[model samples]
Target: MVYPKTGSLIVRDGREMTYTHIQANQTPSRSVCFFFPGASYSFDRPYLYYSTMLFLSKQIDLVHVNAAYGKDIPDFETSSFAKRSAWISEDVKTVVFQVLDQQEYEHVFFLGKSLGTVPIACSLLKEPRFSRSSAILLTPLLREELVVADLLALEQNVFLVSGTADPHYHQPTLERIITSKPNIHRYLPQNAKHSLDIGLQVDLSLQVLQSIMDELGCFLDKSLDI
Candidate 1:
């Protein structure tokens, strides 16, 4: 498959955000997936690449939101947590609105990893359009009340893939939350870390990622009923 095209746009707040657009080349499913990376990660990472390929293989277009910390925006590291979180949420909402306004997508899906899940969760409360959409949350920081509340509020299907050893959430708490929501499909891979890397061996990490991709493929097929 061809690589995605890079594009940049200025949001309403005058903060510039970069995104990658990948058009569907085969089946033209008319579905789109908006990807949000972790705090320090970008769309070029291996995980994002794997996800983009998965969606493309299904003929789903991709819109990957690059991290806003490195450009003209204020450094997230130095800013207060509340301020940074708000900014991230606003940025994501703006991008989503822009994309939807410009395209004619029949189905919208949000794929978020780690800190990225915060904005996806927040958008569900702030934007009514997202309430009807699906979500794939990788290593979601469920410790936040907003995340938990949004997850509870979502009536659509949600696929949550996390590690058994993720530090951001307690296993028992995660289990309880999953048990409370029948719409959520949970996957907990053993000995995996927050990034879903099994260990220091690169080969083993890639193998684990393949397993994740297989799981994600099944979830996508079920969620989209394809």
Candidate 2:
């Protein structure tokens, strides 16, 4: 289950950005998952760590996109939120193209958390080549109506995981949106927060996380027909 991590430095918009690539150990890899972490979260964070392991277990390659605001790239701490998001989107697109150029993956899955979903959604809209790629969105920010609209317009398969108590999004409104779009598979665990932690009790939180991962596994199996 140990996957080798390969690091690469790519320049985008005249700035150096670092990205990590992990190849699955399974022979003849069938798919690749592009991970976009939240604004403040890194690949090492619990949610991403566990999710990445799940995908790796399914024999999927991973490309973890690291943005400028994270500790790995702290030079853009003072940049405006809008500018930072734009830069991250470009960086994500750069890495995506690099991976596509190197391999002919049968299926590409975009995994995004919080603000990370913005870039993935935007990239899919701008690039027709990636239109058929599936997406797994974690705690998408409903505040960005444009992002939500873009996600809705995608004809490709999509799986969304959110918490009922996530402060960043109104549960009622989100539920309504998802209700109208029956094709988008969604999981909203009761009382779970943005991080998908349901309670302070260690056991309870672990249970909630396990349940979410189980749902994600099932969804992936059916979507990719693994």
Candidate 3:
């Protein structure tokens, strides 16, 4: 009985932000996962798409933030990194608060990839209301000092994934977080890029994807005590 409902809201100077809410229509939703895609990645991309399915399978509802910033908002392309991050945070918060106001969810999970992780690290994860929420940061901008600092400050459980080949992957930074923050679990895939795909190795890339999903499932099970 799981189904999806799509809706849109105006945010950040009249820009449109569309989001899809998915859950079992007949079942009461106690948990929800908010998906924040990368600048060039959409919800239909392999990682986000499969993750959406995985959450639904576990009976955790989902909200896909279809914020097409680079394309829909011309200002996004010209804005500085700080400005862009703030814009993203505003858009995400607007959609998330609206959804939460409509219904109460006991558990809140934020999953972000690359550019999307900025808001998760800079805003959502820092907010008092979400201090108890968990986070899944896929290929986060490890090179960014601010993002890494925020991530290190987290107290709730977090699942972090990165690839050795990804330009954003910083060894020293990751080591620091891992050593200091025992609550954050990490997965490092060798020779994988930002997309978590092995360059031109289709089969191996698929296997990597499978492994990530498996680890994510285990994380959810353990975190939820299910």
lDDT of 3 by residue, 1-226 (tens): 6888898999978778899889855665799999999989888899998998889889999998887766656778888777888888998999999999987899999999899888998899888999789889999999887787788888888999999999999999988987899999999999999999999999999999999999999999887783
What tens-digit string does per-residue lDDT give for candidate 1 at 106-181? 8888998888888776664347665567888988887776567677776777888888767865666677666788
Lowest lDDT sum, 10 consecutive residues, model 1, at 67-76
Minimal lDDT window, size 10, model 2: 67-76
Full ranking by lDDT: 3, 1, 2
As a whole number from 0 to 100, the lDDT of residue 53 in candidate 2 is 91
* Candidate 2 lDDT over residue span 31-89, tens digit each: 88889888877788888999999998888888887754556556556676556667777
Cα miss at 5, model 3 (Å)? 1.1
Score each candidate by Cα lDDT: 0.77, 0.77, 0.89
Q: Candidate 2 or 3, higher TM-score? A: 3
- Candidate 1, residue 222: lDDT: 83
- Which candidate, 1 or 3, has the higher TM-score? 3
Best candidate, lDDT: 3
Clash tally, candidates in order: 0, 0, 0
Cα lDDT for residue 13, candidate 3 = 86
